[model samples]
Target: MHEVDMTKCLLISLNEWRDRREDTSAMVETVHLDVGRFTCVEPDQLVTTYNAAVQGTWLDGSRLTITEIPFVGRCLICNGTYDPVPENAYRSPCCDNPLEEIVSGRELRIRSIDYRSDAAAALESAPIQRQR
Candidate 1:
């Protein structure tokens, strides 16, 4: 399911960050994910999967923050943009027309990462050098 893919994505991101910093000792505090309404991924399930996948890894004990993007659409008939309510049969509120273009609600990506960079801390503690 999507959980597998989501877990993979998170691992890939963590790996890339480690590679860039060349430090695997840093602890990740939180991972921010931007998910759209149409991605159909349940927040709770995603968290569980991520936690399980990150066990025994550097990302273990890290928190996950999910930001949901609402389902938005554009009505071709009235040229109106609005949030489609599933209870209302996904119709445009302004013109009562079917949504023609999906303006949003299909996104699933990493928004940002919060981590304590070990390299930065080491650099800060190191003595500064001046050149003449």
Candidate 2:
């Protein structure tokens, strides 16, 4: 089975860490996730795999929290929120109004990363550290 690379996800998590521009040996304990309704994530599977992948890394021992965001479309005619569910052999289901639009079904964001990093302390302990 072709799979979404967990390593890619690990990189994304680390990128979140680096973007904070922090430097430390501190630990990360939790990762907040925002998985879209139609994002194709099997929550149970993802959590299990992600937890295993996070081991032996900076994110080791971290827990992944998956938040389910709804899949909704805004109808342009009446500004209505529509949740799409197609049954049987589908042709294409319309909202009966031309204004329906998908908004939240494809979200990809890392809500937050719980970590501790101390740049100043790291600098102070550096070998041949620079002084201003």
Candidate 3:
């Protein structure tokens, strides 16, 4: 699956980003990603791939949070925006013109990352739970 390749790329990018950071020893806790509906990247599959790939690595146990972005198309002729569903023929609803501009969607990028500088900080930030 292409998700494997995507995961590999993600790892490489994450590593590069970590290397550039001042606290290279920081442990990533979560990665927030924005995935567009039109990008054709299955969030479930990507998450599964990422989980498997990160096992036994520095990123192990890190959570991946995906926010799905809806497909919004803008009509150049009418300057109207619409969501291109199957019933809409992927055209502009205002003028029945072919979608010319994509207002959103088709995005796949890392939005943010949550990390702890050290194990002690991570433990201190953990929620306290009462015993039953």
Candidate 4:
């Protein structure tokens, strides 16, 4: 599954972030991600894969919080927006034009990371990092 690769990339990013910081004892608590419905990334499978992949690592027990972005497309001819579904063939309902411009729903990025530092005794948030 692609989720395995995604998890690997995520771990690499998290490790890179950890390496840059001074607090090596900080443990990742959660990872916030924004996934588009059109991206076809299964949230459940991704979570399961991530949990399995993080086992025995610094990110063990960390959770992934996914926010699903709704699919929105714009009509090329009519300039109207609509939520595309399979029933409509993902085309514009107003002018029967192809959905050429995507207003949203193709996103797949990391919003932020939350961690708990043992030295600080408080939760800390990492800067937002978008995945390419």
Candidate 5:
């Protein structure tokens, strides 16, 4: 089920990128995704699923970069922000209060997309002119 979800997310991101670009000539080079620690999705498994999903597609050779966001919560009593330990256990360091507000750590979305520009590709294929 997790693999399916990851695949779906990748497909959705690719589709969105295509829609925005509207240029079929553009090829994706890298996909940057921000995932929260609380999302419970393993990075390795997600990457594997993404590779499988993009197989034979325009994004086949694209790299997937995941940035993990730590679980952060705000203390209601003292208005202090901190990272929750023990995975989902939110206990305020100040006043020993329960954290009721989540500042972050629930995100799962694409941050940005990198495309293989024509000039960049051309430069790669260009011959090297080394100076003596």
Candidate 6:
């Protein structure tokens, strides 16, 4: 059951990029995936799945870079904003202040794609993954 679900997820992600892939005008290369820290996805697991998913498809030979989104927030006690380190590095009283709401680094998006198009072809590529 887990395997099926994971494959499905991988297929969907690839399909999205493939749908946006173009030839004769531009070539697909990098796919930056925005992986949220709170998204509950294991980095190593995702990497393994993503690598397998891109196989035998148009996304083949392309690179998938997963950018980790840190759990950053403002310190409620001190109002100091900081990027969340590892659990061991997490401090409740940050700079003597507690944390409150986050300012950024929670969203996952395609951001932008790096591709080129010419007069002869009208190819364009969309970003695969990103977190900003």
User: Could you say which candidate leads in TM-score?
Assistant: 4
TM-score of each: 0.81, 0.69, 0.85, 0.86, 0.80, 0.55
lDDT of 1 by residue, 37-114 (tens): 888888788988998988898788898889998889999998888998888788999878877799999888889988
lDDT of candidate 4 over 46-71, digit per residue (tens): 99999999999989889999999999
Q: State each model's CA lDDT, in order.
A: 0.86, 0.66, 0.89, 0.88, 0.82, 0.60
Candidate 1 global CA lDDT score: 0.86
Give stretches of model 6 more than 4 Å off.
Answer: 1-27, 83-91, 94-99, 115-132
Off by over 4 Å in 3: 119-132
lDDT of 3 by residue, 49-82 (tens): 9999999999999989999999999888888889
Report the alpha-carbon TM-score of model 4 versus the true structure: 0.86
lDDT of 4: 0.88
Backbone clash count, each prediction separately? 0, 1, 0, 0, 0, 8
Q: Which of 2 and 6 is ahead in lDDT?
A: 2
List per-candidate RMSD values in Å: 2.5, 5.9, 6.4, 9.0, 4.6, 10.3
Clashing residue pairs for model 4: none
Supply candidate 4's per-residue lDDT for 73: 96
| Candidate 6 local lDDT, residue 84 | 59
Q: Which predicted model would earn the best lDDT?
A: 3
Q: Which 10-residue window of candidate 2 scores lowest in summed lDDT?
A: 86-95
Give residue 106's lDDT in candidate 3 (0 to 100). Answer: 91
TM-score of model 5 vs. true structure? 0.80
> Between the candidate structures 2 and 4, which one is better when assessed by lDDT?
4
Model 1 collision count: 0
Q: Which is the winner by TM-score between candidate 1 and candidate 3?
A: 3
lDDT for residue 117 in candidate 1, whole number 0-100: 77
